[model samples]
Target: MISYRWLLFIVLFVGIFATNYLAMTVKEPLAASAAFTLMVLSVYGLEKFYNRGPEKVTDERTDLINMKAFYYGSLALIVTLMFEFIWLVSEDYETAVLMAKYLLMPFGAMIAVVVLSKAYLERVM
Candidate 1:
């Protein structure tokens, strides 16, 4: 029997292909809507699969490793976002604000969450 992980992989693979095909052939607004919807649903599925516990889906050690990896990934995302924001600011204040609004805050939030979670986990573990 195919595992749920493989099922999730298959769904995401198909979603990516469908999104690419639809985006190229469809109207921009429709394509954007479709992509957004697909992304939301994909994330929902992933969250349900990975976030719930006691299933041996992953152990405490694995979770700690994953959290550590997330912390690093968040760091990278925030650093790149800051550089982008600086470049945007050099270009124009209005553009900088617009770009930073979409980029910096979300990345910063993720970094904070990951860093704190990793710290807490390390302390307890």
Candidate 2:
């Protein structure tokens, strides 16, 4: 049976797609929405396929690794966000348009930190 998490992701994808489509004033909304939906479904399917394994058993070690990874990721996110804020404030940002463009850096930093930290922790611990 499908889970609520999957439904939430699908809804988020559709909402994001619709928001961007409307904002960009795209001509072919139908085709774009169909393609976006297909892409989201394909990714969801791929994740499901990849996760078809035995049920996960978490223990102290696994929990510690995850905790540390999240800690590092949060640190990286905060640092990057601080830097982004400083840079933006040093310059001139009339609206949130420029701030929106800069937001990806912190997000990428967080993801990179989490992935790398998890990989390293898994290997070492």
**Candidate with maximal lDDT:** 1
lDDT of 2 by residue, 16-123 (tens): 565355334454444444554555556657667767899679899989788855675576566455444434433434443577667778678767877887789889
The true-versus-predicted C-alpha distance at residue 24 of model 1, in Å, is 3.1
Compare the candidates by TM-score and give the number of the best one.
Answer: 2
Q: What's the distance in Å from true for residue 78, model 1?
A: 14
What ranges in model 1 sit over 4 Å off?
42-116, 119-125
What is the clash count of model 2?
0
RMSD of 2: 9.8
Using all chains and alpha carbons, the TM-scores for the candidates as numbered come to 0.38, 0.42
- In candidate 2, position 35 carries an lDDT of 50
lDDT of 2: 0.61
